[model samples]
Target: MSWIFLFFAGLLEIGWAIGLKYTDGFTRPAPTLFTIASMIASLALLGLALKTLPVGTAYAVWTGIGTVGTALLGVWLLGEPATATRLACIGLIVAGIVGLKLAA
Candidate 1:
Protein backbone atom coordinates (compact mmCIF):
# COMPACT_ATOMS: atom_id res chain seq x y z
CA MET A 1 0.00 0.00 0.00
CA SER A 2 2.76 2.38 0.85
CA TRP A 3 4.54 1.43 -2.34
CA ILE A 4 1.34 2.16 -4.24
CA PHE A 5 1.10 5.55 -2.59
CA LEU A 6 4.75 6.22 -3.40
CA PHE A 7 4.24 5.27 -7.01
CA PHE A 8 1.31 7.61 -7.43
CA ALA A 9 3.22 10.32 -5.61
CA GLY A 10 6.05 9.87 -8.09
CA LEU A 11 3.59 10.16 -10.96
CA LEU A 12 2.22 13.37 -9.49
CA GLU A 13 5.76 14.64 -9.21
CA ILE A 14 6.10 14.11 -12.95
CA GLY A 15 2.82 15.94 -13.51
CA TRP A 16 3.96 19.01 -11.62
CA ALA A 17 7.43 18.90 -13.10
CA ILE A 18 6.03 18.99 -16.62
CA GLY A 19 3.26 21.34 -15.55
CA LEU A 20 5.85 23.96 -14.73
CA LYS A 21 6.57 24.48 -18.42
CA TYR A 22 2.88 24.84 -19.22
CA THR A 23 2.51 27.39 -16.45
CA ASP A 24 4.76 29.86 -18.32
CA GLY A 25 6.40 31.18 -15.19
CA PHE A 26 3.07 30.96 -13.42
CA THR A 27 1.50 33.60 -15.65
CA ARG A 28 -1.02 31.03 -16.83
CA PRO A 29 -3.69 30.68 -14.16
CA ALA A 30 -5.10 27.25 -14.98
CA PRO A 31 -1.81 25.43 -15.36
CA THR A 32 -0.44 27.19 -12.33
CA LEU A 33 -3.34 25.99 -10.23
CA PHE A 34 -3.03 22.47 -11.57
CA THR A 35 0.69 22.43 -10.89
CA ILE A 36 0.22 23.74 -7.37
CA ALA A 37 -2.45 21.14 -6.65
CA SER A 38 -0.22 18.39 -7.97
CA MET A 39 2.68 19.60 -5.85
CA ILE A 40 0.60 19.47 -2.68
CA ALA A 41 -0.85 16.09 -3.51
CA SER A 42 2.54 14.67 -4.37
CA LEU A 43 4.00 15.78 -1.07
CA ALA A 44 1.02 14.45 0.83
CA LEU A 45 1.35 11.06 -0.83
CA LEU A 46 5.08 11.02 -0.18
CA GLY A 47 4.35 11.67 3.48
CA LEU A 48 1.98 8.73 3.56
CA ALA A 49 4.58 6.45 2.01
CA LEU A 50 7.21 7.66 4.45
CA LYS A 51 5.25 6.06 7.26
CA THR A 52 6.68 2.69 6.25
CA LEU A 53 9.29 3.14 3.53
CA PRO A 54 12.82 4.10 4.31
CA VAL A 55 13.34 7.80 3.62
CA GLY A 56 16.44 7.25 1.49
CA THR A 57 14.96 4.58 -0.72
CA ALA A 58 11.62 6.33 -1.07
CA TYR A 59 13.15 9.67 -1.90
CA ALA A 60 15.47 8.24 -4.52
CA VAL A 61 12.71 6.24 -6.14
CA TRP A 62 10.34 9.18 -6.08
CA THR A 63 12.81 11.50 -7.75
CA GLY A 64 13.90 8.77 -10.13
CA ILE A 65 10.37 8.26 -11.39
CA GLY A 66 9.82 11.96 -11.76
CA THR A 67 13.09 12.45 -13.59
CA VAL A 68 12.52 9.63 -16.02
CA GLY A 69 8.91 10.57 -16.74
CA THR A 70 9.68 14.22 -17.14
CA ALA A 71 12.59 13.56 -19.46
CA LEU A 72 10.59 11.22 -21.67
CA LEU A 73 7.67 13.61 -21.76
CA GLY A 74 9.97 16.46 -22.64
CA VAL A 75 11.31 14.52 -25.59
CA TRP A 76 7.89 13.36 -26.76
CA LEU A 77 5.88 16.51 -26.11
CA LEU A 78 8.37 19.36 -26.02
CA GLY A 79 10.65 18.37 -28.88
CA GLU A 80 13.60 17.87 -26.58
CA PRO A 81 16.52 15.80 -27.79
CA ALA A 82 16.40 12.05 -27.12
CA THR A 83 20.01 11.20 -27.48
CA ALA A 84 21.28 7.70 -26.80
CA THR A 85 23.41 8.79 -23.87
CA ARG A 86 20.50 10.62 -22.30
CA LEU A 87 18.26 7.57 -22.64
CA ALA A 88 20.95 5.31 -21.21
CA CYS A 89 21.22 7.52 -18.17
CA ILE A 90 17.48 7.37 -17.71
CA GLY A 91 17.67 3.60 -17.91
CA LEU A 92 20.29 3.60 -15.23
CA ILE A 93 18.02 5.63 -13.02
CA VAL A 94 15.22 3.15 -13.61
CA ALA A 95 17.56 0.30 -12.70
CA GLY A 96 18.52 2.08 -9.52
CA ILE A 97 14.88 2.57 -8.64
CA VAL A 98 14.22 -1.11 -9.21
CA GLY A 99 17.21 -2.06 -7.14
CA LEU A 100 16.07 0.14 -4.30
CA LYS A 101 12.59 -1.34 -4.41
CA LEU A 102 14.01 -4.85 -4.30
CA ALA A 103 16.34 -4.00 -1.45
CA ALA A 104 13.54 -2.45 0.56
Candidate 2:
Protein backbone atom coordinates (compact mmCIF):
# COMPACT_ATOMS: atom_id res chain seq x y z
CA MET A 1 0.00 0.00 0.00
CA SER A 2 0.96 3.63 -0.43
CA TRP A 3 0.77 4.26 3.28
CA ILE A 4 3.13 1.37 3.94
CA PHE A 5 5.60 2.67 1.42
CA LEU A 6 5.34 6.10 2.94
CA PHE A 7 6.02 4.73 6.39
CA PHE A 8 9.19 2.96 5.28
CA ALA A 9 10.22 6.00 3.30
CA GLY A 10 9.95 8.12 6.40
CA LEU A 11 12.00 5.57 8.32
CA LEU A 12 14.61 5.54 5.59
CA GLU A 13 14.67 9.30 5.78
CA ILE A 14 15.56 9.00 9.43
CA GLY A 15 18.21 6.42 8.61
CA TRP A 16 19.75 8.65 5.97
CA ALA A 17 19.70 11.56 8.37
CA ILE A 18 21.53 9.58 10.99
CA GLY A 19 23.85 8.25 8.35
CA LEU A 20 24.64 11.82 7.37
CA LYS A 21 25.93 12.40 10.86
CA TYR A 22 28.27 9.47 10.46
CA THR A 23 29.47 10.46 7.01
CA ASP A 24 31.79 13.19 8.37
CA GLY A 25 31.29 15.47 5.41
CA PHE A 26 31.46 12.56 3.02
CA THR A 27 34.99 11.69 3.96
CA ARG A 28 34.02 8.26 5.28
CA PRO A 29 33.45 5.97 2.38
CA ALA A 30 31.20 3.35 3.96
CA PRO A 31 28.92 5.67 5.84
CA THR A 32 28.75 8.03 2.91
CA LEU A 33 27.73 5.18 0.67
CA PHE A 34 25.13 4.08 3.16
CA THR A 35 23.78 7.59 3.41
CA ILE A 36 23.54 7.99 -0.34
CA ALA A 37 21.84 4.64 -0.73
CA SER A 38 19.29 5.39 1.94
CA MET A 39 18.65 8.83 0.48
CA ILE A 40 17.91 7.42 -2.94
CA ALA A 41 15.78 4.64 -1.55
CA SER A 42 13.81 7.07 0.57
CA LEU A 43 13.08 9.37 -2.36
CA ALA A 44 12.13 6.48 -4.56
CA LEU A 45 9.73 5.21 -1.95
CA LEU A 46 8.27 8.66 -1.54
CA GLY A 47 7.63 8.78 -5.26
CA LEU A 48 5.90 5.45 -5.12
CA ALA A 49 3.72 6.59 -2.26
CA LEU A 50 2.82 9.77 -4.11
CA LYS A 51 1.23 7.66 -6.81
CA THR A 52 -1.80 7.29 -4.59
CA LEU A 53 -1.58 9.75 -1.71
CA PRO A 54 -2.33 13.45 -1.98
CA VAL A 55 0.85 15.36 -2.57
CA GLY A 56 0.69 18.05 0.08
CA THR A 57 -0.61 15.79 2.80
CA ALA A 58 1.81 13.01 1.98
CA TYR A 59 4.76 15.35 1.94
CA ALA A 60 3.84 16.96 5.24
CA VAL A 61 3.34 13.60 6.88
CA TRP A 62 6.54 12.19 5.44
CA THR A 63 8.66 15.05 6.65
CA GLY A 64 6.89 15.09 9.98
CA ILE A 65 7.69 11.43 10.54
CA GLY A 66 11.28 11.93 9.47
CA THR A 67 11.79 14.95 11.68
CA VAL A 68 10.27 13.42 14.75
CA GLY A 69 11.97 10.07 14.22
CA THR A 70 15.37 11.58 13.66
CA ALA A 71 15.06 13.72 16.75
CA LEU A 72 14.18 10.74 18.85
CA LEU A 73 16.99 8.66 17.39
CA GLY A 74 19.44 11.47 17.99
CA VAL A 75 18.52 11.62 21.62
CA TRP A 76 18.43 7.90 22.22
CA LEU A 77 21.33 6.72 20.11
CA LEU A 78 23.52 9.73 19.36
CA GLY A 79 23.63 11.38 22.77
CA GLU A 80 21.91 14.50 21.53
CA PRO A 81 20.10 16.87 23.85
CA ALA A 82 16.94 15.58 25.50
CA THR A 83 15.39 18.57 27.07
CA ALA A 84 11.70 18.70 27.90
CA THR A 85 11.07 21.44 25.34
CA ARG A 86 12.58 19.34 22.58
CA LEU A 87 10.41 16.40 23.56
CA ALA A 88 7.32 18.61 23.58
CA CYS A 89 8.12 19.90 20.13
CA ILE A 90 8.54 16.35 18.88
CA GLY A 91 5.21 15.46 20.41
CA LEU A 92 3.55 18.37 18.66
CA ILE A 93 4.97 17.21 15.36
CA VAL A 94 3.64 13.74 16.09
CA ALA A 95 0.21 15.20 16.84
CA GLY A 96 0.27 17.04 13.55
CA ILE A 97 1.25 13.86 11.71
CA VAL A 98 -1.57 11.98 13.38
CA GLY A 99 -3.99 14.75 12.57
CA LEU A 100 -2.95 14.68 8.94
CA LYS A 101 -3.38 10.91 8.76
CA LEU A 102 -6.80 11.19 10.32
CA ALA A 103 -7.84 13.93 7.96
CA ALA A 104 -6.64 11.94 5.00
Candidate 3:
Protein backbone atom coordinates (compact mmCIF):
# COMPACT_ATOMS: atom_id res chain seq x y z
CA MET A 1 0.00 0.00 0.00
CA SER A 2 2.92 2.30 0.65
CA TRP A 3 4.26 1.67 -2.80
CA ILE A 4 0.85 2.23 -4.28
CA PHE A 5 0.55 5.52 -2.45
CA LEU A 6 3.94 6.58 -3.69
CA PHE A 7 2.99 5.70 -7.24
CA PHE A 8 -0.12 7.82 -7.09
CA ALA A 9 1.86 10.56 -5.42
CA GLY A 10 4.35 10.47 -8.24
CA LEU A 11 1.55 10.72 -10.78
CA LEU A 12 0.20 13.72 -8.91
CA GLU A 13 3.62 15.29 -9.20
CA ILE A 14 3.35 14.83 -12.96
CA GLY A 15 0.03 16.62 -12.90
CA TRP A 16 1.51 19.51 -10.99
CA ALA A 17 4.44 19.74 -13.37
CA ILE A 18 2.28 19.84 -16.48
CA GLY A 19 -0.10 22.27 -14.87
CA LEU A 20 2.84 24.52 -14.11
CA LYS A 21 3.45 24.93 -17.82
CA TYR A 22 -0.03 26.26 -18.32
CA THR A 23 -0.01 28.38 -15.17
CA ASP A 24 1.97 31.24 -16.71
CA GLY A 25 3.68 32.00 -13.43
CA PHE A 26 0.45 31.47 -11.59
CA THR A 27 -1.36 34.22 -13.42
CA ARG A 28 -3.96 31.90 -14.92
CA PRO A 29 -6.58 30.88 -12.38
CA ALA A 30 -7.57 27.46 -13.68
CA PRO A 31 -4.13 26.06 -14.28
CA THR A 32 -2.85 27.60 -11.11
CA LEU A 33 -5.62 25.88 -9.20
CA PHE A 34 -4.70 22.60 -10.82
CA THR A 35 -1.09 23.10 -9.91
CA ILE A 36 -1.98 23.75 -6.29
CA ALA A 37 -4.34 20.80 -6.15
CA SER A 38 -1.82 18.39 -7.57
CA MET A 39 0.91 19.63 -5.27
CA ILE A 40 -1.34 19.17 -2.26
CA ALA A 41 -2.32 15.69 -3.34
CA SER A 42 1.27 14.70 -3.99
CA LEU A 43 2.48 15.93 -0.65
CA ALA A 44 -0.40 14.34 1.17
CA LEU A 45 0.26 10.97 -0.39
CA LEU A 46 3.94 11.23 0.29
CA GLY A 47 3.17 11.87 3.94
CA LEU A 48 0.87 8.88 4.04
CA ALA A 49 3.40 6.60 2.37
CA LEU A 50 6.07 7.60 4.84
CA LYS A 51 4.18 5.72 7.52
CA THR A 52 5.56 2.47 6.13
CA LEU A 53 8.35 3.48 3.76
CA PRO A 54 11.82 4.67 4.62
CA VAL A 55 12.01 8.39 4.17
CA GLY A 56 15.13 8.60 2.03
CA THR A 57 14.22 5.75 -0.26
CA ALA A 58 10.60 6.85 -0.61
CA TYR A 59 11.62 10.40 -1.39
CA ALA A 60 14.16 9.37 -4.01
CA VAL A 61 11.72 7.11 -5.78
CA TRP A 62 8.93 9.62 -5.57
CA THR A 63 11.04 12.37 -7.11
CA GLY A 64 12.52 10.06 -9.75
CA ILE A 65 9.12 8.90 -10.94
CA GLY A 66 7.81 12.43 -11.06
CA THR A 67 10.81 13.77 -12.97
CA VAL A 68 10.73 11.06 -15.61
CA GLY A 69 6.98 11.10 -16.01
CA THR A 70 6.88 14.84 -16.45
CA ALA A 71 9.73 14.81 -18.95
CA LEU A 72 7.97 12.23 -21.08
CA LEU A 73 4.72 14.16 -20.83
CA GLY A 74 6.53 17.23 -22.01
CA VAL A 75 7.83 15.40 -25.03
CA TRP A 76 4.54 13.80 -25.95
CA LEU A 77 1.98 16.39 -24.99
CA LEU A 78 3.81 19.69 -25.24
CA GLY A 79 5.92 18.98 -28.31
CA GLU A 80 9.09 19.27 -26.32
CA PRO A 81 11.91 17.61 -28.18
CA ALA A 82 12.28 13.87 -27.82
CA THR A 83 15.69 13.82 -29.38
CA ALA A 84 18.06 10.90 -29.01
CA THR A 85 19.93 12.52 -26.16
CA ARG A 86 16.78 13.38 -24.25
CA LEU A 87 15.40 9.90 -24.71
CA ALA A 88 18.64 8.44 -23.47
CA CYS A 89 18.46 10.58 -20.37
CA ILE A 90 14.89 9.55 -19.81
CA GLY A 91 15.93 5.91 -20.15
CA LEU A 92 18.59 6.46 -17.55
CA ILE A 93 16.05 7.96 -15.18
CA VAL A 94 13.77 4.96 -15.67
CA ALA A 95 16.64 2.58 -15.03
CA GLY A 96 17.57 4.40 -11.86
CA ILE A 97 14.00 4.43 -10.57
CA VAL A 98 13.54 0.74 -11.27
CA GLY A 99 16.87 -0.08 -9.73
CA LEU A 100 16.00 1.84 -6.58
CA LYS A 101 12.68 0.07 -6.24
CA LEU A 102 14.29 -3.33 -6.71
CA ALA A 103 17.15 -2.64 -4.37
CA ALA A 104 14.92 -1.09 -1.75
Candidate 4:
Protein backbone atom coordinates (compact mmCIF):
# COMPACT_ATOMS: atom_id res chain seq x y z
CA MET A 1 0.00 0.00 0.00
CA SER A 2 2.80 2.37 0.88
CA TRP A 3 4.66 1.44 -2.27
CA ILE A 4 1.51 2.08 -4.24
CA PHE A 5 1.19 5.50 -2.71
CA LEU A 6 4.83 6.20 -3.43
CA PHE A 7 4.43 5.16 -7.04
CA PHE A 8 1.51 7.46 -7.60
CA ALA A 9 3.37 10.20 -5.76
CA GLY A 10 6.30 9.74 -8.09
CA LEU A 11 3.95 9.92 -11.09
CA LEU A 12 2.46 13.13 -9.79
CA GLU A 13 5.95 14.47 -9.32
CA ILE A 14 6.45 13.85 -13.04
CA GLY A 15 3.21 15.62 -13.80
CA TRP A 16 4.15 18.68 -11.83
CA ALA A 17 7.68 18.69 -13.17
CA ILE A 18 6.47 18.67 -16.74
CA GLY A 19 3.61 20.96 -15.90
CA LEU A 20 6.11 23.66 -15.03
CA LYS A 21 6.90 24.12 -18.70
CA TYR A 22 3.24 24.29 -19.68
CA THR A 23 2.66 26.85 -16.95
CA ASP A 24 4.88 29.33 -18.82
CA GLY A 25 6.24 30.91 -15.68
CA PHE A 26 2.81 30.96 -14.06
CA THR A 27 1.44 33.22 -16.75
CA ARG A 28 -0.91 30.56 -18.04
CA PRO A 29 -3.79 30.26 -15.64
CA ALA A 30 -5.06 26.75 -16.40
CA PRO A 31 -1.68 25.05 -16.53
CA THR A 32 -0.57 26.96 -13.46
CA LEU A 33 -3.56 25.70 -11.52
CA PHE A 34 -2.99 22.16 -12.71
CA THR A 35 0.65 22.37 -11.80
CA ILE A 36 -0.15 23.67 -8.33
CA ALA A 37 -2.69 20.91 -7.78
CA SER A 38 -0.22 18.26 -8.89
CA MET A 39 2.43 19.68 -6.59
CA ILE A 40 0.08 19.55 -3.59
CA ALA A 41 -1.09 16.04 -4.36
CA SER A 42 2.42 14.79 -4.98
CA LEU A 43 3.64 16.08 -1.64
CA ALA A 44 0.60 14.72 0.15
CA LEU A 45 1.14 11.28 -1.31
CA LEU A 46 4.85 11.43 -0.51
CA GLY A 47 3.93 12.20 3.09
CA LEU A 48 1.67 9.16 3.18
CA ALA A 49 4.41 6.90 1.82
CA LEU A 50 6.90 8.29 4.29
CA LYS A 51 4.93 6.61 7.07
CA THR A 52 6.31 3.26 5.91
CA LEU A 53 9.22 3.97 3.60
CA PRO A 54 12.64 5.21 4.54
CA VAL A 55 13.06 8.89 3.76
CA GLY A 56 16.29 8.40 1.82
CA THR A 57 14.94 5.62 -0.35
CA ALA A 58 11.58 7.25 -0.92
CA TYR A 59 13.07 10.60 -1.81
CA ALA A 60 15.53 9.12 -4.26
CA VAL A 61 12.88 6.99 -5.90
CA TRP A 62 10.43 9.85 -6.09
CA THR A 63 12.91 12.14 -7.79
CA GLY A 64 14.19 9.33 -9.94
CA ILE A 65 10.74 8.68 -11.35
CA GLY A 66 10.20 12.34 -11.91
CA THR A 67 13.57 12.82 -13.58
CA VAL A 68 13.15 9.88 -15.89
CA GLY A 69 9.59 10.71 -16.85
CA THR A 70 10.36 14.36 -17.36
CA ALA A 71 13.38 13.64 -19.50
CA LEU A 72 11.52 11.20 -21.67
CA LEU A 73 8.60 13.53 -22.03
CA GLY A 74 10.92 16.36 -22.89
CA VAL A 75 12.39 14.32 -25.68
CA TRP A 76 9.04 13.10 -26.93
CA LEU A 77 6.96 16.22 -26.50
CA LEU A 78 9.34 19.13 -26.13
CA GLY A 79 11.79 18.17 -28.87
CA GLU A 80 14.71 17.85 -26.48
CA PRO A 81 17.74 15.86 -27.50
CA ALA A 82 17.73 12.12 -26.80
CA THR A 83 21.41 11.46 -27.07
CA ALA A 84 22.87 8.09 -26.17
CA THR A 85 24.87 9.38 -23.24
CA ARG A 86 21.86 11.22 -21.86
CA LEU A 87 19.73 8.11 -22.12
CA ALA A 88 22.46 6.00 -20.51
CA CYS A 89 22.51 8.34 -17.53
CA ILE A 90 18.77 8.04 -17.28
CA GLY A 91 19.19 4.28 -17.36
CA LEU A 92 21.63 4.51 -14.50
CA ILE A 93 19.10 6.47 -12.52
CA VAL A 94 16.57 3.75 -13.20
CA ALA A 95 19.08 1.18 -12.04
CA GLY A 96 19.58 3.10 -8.83
CA ILE A 97 15.85 3.33 -8.30
CA VAL A 98 15.49 -0.40 -8.75
CA GLY A 99 18.41 -1.05 -6.44
CA LEU A 100 16.92 1.15 -3.75
CA LYS A 101 13.57 -0.59 -4.01
CA LEU A 102 15.25 -3.97 -3.75
CA ALA A 103 17.22 -2.89 -0.72
CA ALA A 104 14.12 -1.52 0.91
Candidate 5:
Protein backbone atom coordinates (compact mmCIF):
# COMPACT_ATOMS: atom_id res chain seq x y z
CA MET A 1 0.00 0.00 0.00
CA SER A 2 2.00 2.91 -1.22
CA TRP A 3 -0.64 5.34 -0.05
CA ILE A 4 -0.46 3.82 3.42
CA PHE A 5 3.27 4.21 3.45
CA LEU A 6 2.82 7.77 2.29
CA PHE A 7 0.43 8.42 5.19
CA PHE A 8 2.98 7.15 7.68
CA ALA A 9 5.63 9.14 5.93
CA GLY A 10 3.51 12.25 6.38
CA LEU A 11 3.06 11.52 10.08
CA LEU A 12 6.78 11.03 10.51
CA GLU A 13 7.37 14.27 8.67
CA ILE A 14 5.29 16.01 11.33
CA GLY A 15 7.30 14.28 14.03
CA TRP A 16 10.60 15.31 12.50
CA ALA A 17 9.43 18.90 12.14
CA ILE A 18 8.30 19.16 15.76
CA GLY A 19 11.48 17.44 16.84
CA LEU A 20 13.47 20.01 14.96
CA LYS A 21 11.78 22.75 16.96
CA TYR A 22 12.57 21.03 20.22
CA THR A 23 16.14 20.33 19.23
CA ASP A 24 17.04 23.97 19.86
CA GLY A 25 19.58 24.26 17.09
CA PHE A 26 20.75 20.75 17.95
CA THR A 27 21.64 21.81 21.47
CA ARG A 28 19.11 19.48 23.06
CA PRO A 29 20.22 15.87 22.91
CA ALA A 30 16.81 14.27 23.39
CA PRO A 31 15.08 16.24 20.68
CA THR A 32 18.10 15.96 18.43
CA LEU A 33 17.91 12.17 18.69
CA PHE A 34 14.20 12.34 18.00
CA THR A 35 14.82 14.53 15.00
CA ILE A 36 17.33 12.07 13.59
CA ALA A 37 15.13 9.06 14.26
CA SER A 38 12.02 10.61 12.78
CA MET A 39 13.95 11.82 9.74
CA ILE A 40 15.19 8.27 9.13
CA ALA A 41 11.72 6.85 9.55
CA SER A 42 10.15 9.44 7.27
CA LEU A 43 12.68 8.88 4.51
CA ALA A 44 12.41 5.11 4.82
CA LEU A 45 8.66 5.16 4.38
CA LEU A 46 8.89 7.67 1.53
CA GLY A 47 11.34 5.39 -0.24
CA LEU A 48 9.04 2.42 0.21
CA ALA A 49 6.06 4.37 -1.04
CA LEU A 50 7.96 5.45 -4.12
CA LYS A 51 8.41 1.81 -5.16
CA THR A 52 4.87 1.77 -6.54
CA LEU A 53 3.72 5.36 -6.77
CA PRO A 54 4.87 7.59 -9.57
CA VAL A 55 7.74 9.68 -8.31
CA GLY A 56 6.22 13.05 -9.16
CA THR A 57 2.88 12.18 -7.66
CA ALA A 58 4.37 10.62 -4.56
CA TYR A 59 6.78 13.47 -3.96
CA ALA A 60 4.18 16.18 -4.48
CA VAL A 61 1.70 14.53 -2.17
CA TRP A 62 4.28 13.80 0.49
CA THR A 63 5.62 17.32 0.57
CA GLY A 64 2.21 18.97 0.35
CA ILE A 65 0.80 16.94 3.21
CA GLY A 66 3.93 17.37 5.31
CA THR A 67 4.12 21.10 4.75
CA VAL A 68 0.47 21.75 5.48
CA GLY A 69 0.47 19.54 8.56
CA THR A 70 3.61 21.12 9.95
CA ALA A 71 2.36 24.62 9.28
CA LEU A 72 -0.90 23.92 11.06
CA LEU A 73 0.93 22.35 13.96
CA GLY A 74 3.06 25.43 14.27
CA VAL A 75 0.03 27.65 14.27
CA TRP A 76 -1.91 25.59 16.78
CA LEU A 77 0.65 24.16 19.17
CA LEU A 78 3.45 26.66 18.86
CA GLY A 79 1.41 29.85 18.70
CA GLU A 80 2.76 30.82 15.32
CA PRO A 81 0.92 33.47 13.40
CA ALA A 82 -1.94 32.42 11.12
CA THR A 83 -2.78 35.31 8.92
CA ALA A 84 -5.63 35.12 6.45
CA THR A 85 -3.23 35.18 3.53
CA ARG A 86 -1.31 32.30 5.02
CA LEU A 87 -4.52 30.33 5.46
CA ALA A 88 -5.47 30.97 1.85
CA CYS A 89 -2.08 29.78 0.67
CA ILE A 90 -2.41 26.66 2.74
CA GLY A 91 -5.80 26.01 1.18
CA LEU A 92 -4.28 26.39 -2.26
CA ILE A 93 -1.62 23.86 -1.43
CA VAL A 94 -4.25 21.38 -0.28
CA ALA A 95 -6.31 21.99 -3.39
CA GLY A 96 -3.29 21.42 -5.61
CA ILE A 97 -2.50 18.19 -3.80
CA VAL A 98 -6.04 16.98 -4.37
CA GLY A 99 -5.96 17.99 -8.03
CA LEU A 100 -2.75 16.04 -8.57
CA LYS A 101 -4.25 12.96 -6.99
CA LEU A 102 -7.35 13.31 -9.13
CA ALA A 103 -5.21 13.57 -12.24
CA ALA A 104 -3.18 10.59 -11.18
Candidate 6:
Protein backbone atom coordinates (compact mmCIF):
# COMPACT_ATOMS: atom_id res chain seq x y z
CA MET A 1 0.00 0.00 0.00
CA SER A 2 1.04 3.57 -0.56
CA TRP A 3 0.50 4.36 3.11
CA ILE A 4 2.86 1.59 4.07
CA PHE A 5 5.51 2.96 1.79
CA LEU A 6 4.95 6.44 3.16
CA PHE A 7 5.23 5.19 6.73
CA PHE A 8 8.53 3.46 6.08
CA ALA A 9 9.77 6.48 4.22
CA GLY A 10 9.00 8.50 7.28
CA LEU A 11 10.99 6.04 9.39
CA LEU A 12 13.87 6.33 6.99
CA GLU A 13 13.60 10.07 7.27
CA ILE A 14 14.17 9.62 10.98
CA GLY A 15 17.13 7.39 10.26
CA TRP A 16 18.77 9.97 8.03
CA ALA A 17 18.11 12.75 10.51
CA ILE A 18 19.90 10.90 13.30
CA GLY A 19 22.50 9.88 10.80
CA LEU A 20 23.14 13.56 10.17
CA LYS A 21 23.92 14.05 13.83
CA TYR A 22 26.33 11.16 13.73
CA THR A 23 27.95 12.55 10.58
CA ASP A 24 29.73 15.39 12.45
CA GLY A 25 29.59 17.65 9.44
CA PHE A 26 30.25 14.73 7.14
CA THR A 27 33.67 14.15 8.66
CA ARG A 28 32.72 10.69 9.89
CA PRO A 29 32.86 8.43 6.90
CA ALA A 30 30.64 5.62 8.10
CA PRO A 31 27.80 7.71 9.46
CA THR A 32 27.99 10.05 6.53
CA LEU A 33 27.61 7.15 4.15
CA PHE A 34 24.74 5.79 6.15
CA THR A 35 23.10 9.19 6.17
CA ILE A 36 23.41 9.61 2.42
CA ALA A 37 22.04 6.15 1.79
CA SER A 38 19.09 6.64 4.07
CA MET A 39 18.39 10.01 2.57
CA ILE A 40 18.18 8.46 -0.88
CA ALA A 41 15.99 5.64 0.28
CA SER A 42 13.69 8.03 2.09
CA LEU A 43 13.22 10.25 -0.94
CA ALA A 44 12.74 7.29 -3.21
CA LEU A 45 10.05 5.94 -1.00
CA LEU A 46 8.41 9.34 -0.85
CA GLY A 47 8.35 9.44 -4.60
CA LEU A 48 6.74 6.04 -4.71
CA ALA A 49 4.06 7.12 -2.26
CA LEU A 50 3.39 10.26 -4.21
CA LYS A 51 2.03 8.08 -6.96
CA THR A 52 -1.16 7.73 -4.95
CA LEU A 53 -1.16 10.14 -2.02
CA PRO A 54 -1.64 13.86 -2.12
CA VAL A 55 1.68 15.66 -2.01
CA GLY A 56 0.82 18.04 0.78
CA THR A 57 -0.52 15.31 3.02
CA ALA A 58 2.30 12.92 2.32
CA TYR A 59 5.01 15.51 2.90
CA ALA A 60 3.50 16.76 6.12
CA VAL A 61 3.08 13.26 7.47
CA TRP A 62 6.57 12.25 6.44
CA THR A 63 8.17 15.24 8.12
CA GLY A 64 5.86 14.91 11.08
CA ILE A 65 7.01 11.38 11.71
CA GLY A 66 10.62 12.35 11.25
CA THR A 67 10.31 15.37 13.52
CA VAL A 68 8.57 13.47 16.30
CA GLY A 69 10.85 10.46 16.06
CA THR A 70 14.00 12.53 16.03
CA ALA A 71 12.87 14.64 18.97
CA LEU A 72 12.06 11.58 21.02
CA LEU A 73 15.29 9.90 20.02
CA GLY A 74 17.23 13.02 20.92
CA VAL A 75 15.73 12.96 24.39
CA TRP A 76 16.30 9.25 24.85
CA LEU A 77 19.55 8.63 23.04
CA LEU A 78 21.24 12.02 22.67
CA GLY A 79 20.37 13.59 26.03
CA GLU A 80 18.49 16.51 24.49
CA PRO A 81 16.18 18.52 26.67
CA ALA A 82 12.62 17.18 27.06
CA THR A 83 10.78 20.15 28.40
CA ALA A 84 6.99 20.25 28.65
CA THR A 85 6.76 22.98 26.06
CA ARG A 86 8.74 20.96 23.57
CA LEU A 87 6.57 17.94 24.26
CA ALA A 88 3.45 20.02 23.74
CA CYS A 89 4.68 21.24 20.37
CA ILE A 90 5.40 17.68 19.34
CA GLY A 91 1.86 16.78 20.35
CA LEU A 92 0.53 19.50 18.11
CA ILE A 93 2.48 18.11 15.20
CA VAL A 94 1.02 14.70 15.91
CA ALA A 95 -2.46 16.16 15.91
CA GLY A 96 -1.84 17.87 12.59
CA ILE A 97 -0.51 14.72 11.03
CA VAL A 98 -3.52 12.76 12.21
CA GLY A 99 -5.81 15.45 10.95
CA LEU A 100 -4.26 15.31 7.52
CA LYS A 101 -4.60 11.55 7.45
CA LEU A 102 -8.23 11.78 8.43
CA ALA A 103 -8.96 14.44 5.89
CA ALA A 104 -7.36 12.37 3.18
Which one is best on lDDT?
A: 1
Ranking by TM-score: 1, 4, 2, 6, 3, 5
Model 4 accuracy (lDDT, Cα): 0.96
Worst 10 residues of 4 by lDDT: 1-10
- Deviating ranges (above 4 Å) for candidate 5: none
lDDT of 1 by residue, 7-93 (tens): 999999999999999999999999999999999999999999999999999999999999999999999999999999999999999
Q: How close is candidate 5 to the true structure, as a TM-score?
A: 0.94
Would you estimate the TM-scores of all the predictions? 0.99, 0.97, 0.95, 0.98, 0.94, 0.97
lDDT of 1: 0.98
Candidate order, lDDT descending: 1, 6, 4, 2, 3, 5
Candidate 4 vs 6: which has more TM-score: 4
Compare candidates 3 and 6 on TM-score and give the better one: 6
Clashing pairs in 1: none
Give the 10-residue window scoring lowest on summed lDDT in candidate 2. Answer: 56-65
How far out, in Å, is residue 6 in model 3? 0.1
lDDT of 2 at 63: 97
Runs of candidate 3 with Cα error greater than 4 angstroms are none
**Per-residue lDDT over 1-104 for candidate 2, one digit per residue giving the tens place of the 0 to 100 score:** 99999999999999999999999999999999999999999999999999999999999988998999999999999999999999999999999999999999
Cα distance off (Å), candidate 2, residue 95:
0.4
Relative to the unseen true structure, what is the C-alpha lDDT of residue 70 in candidate 1, on a scale of 0 to 100?
99
Please state every model's RMSD to the true fold in angstroms.
0.4, 0.7, 0.9, 0.5, 0.9, 0.7
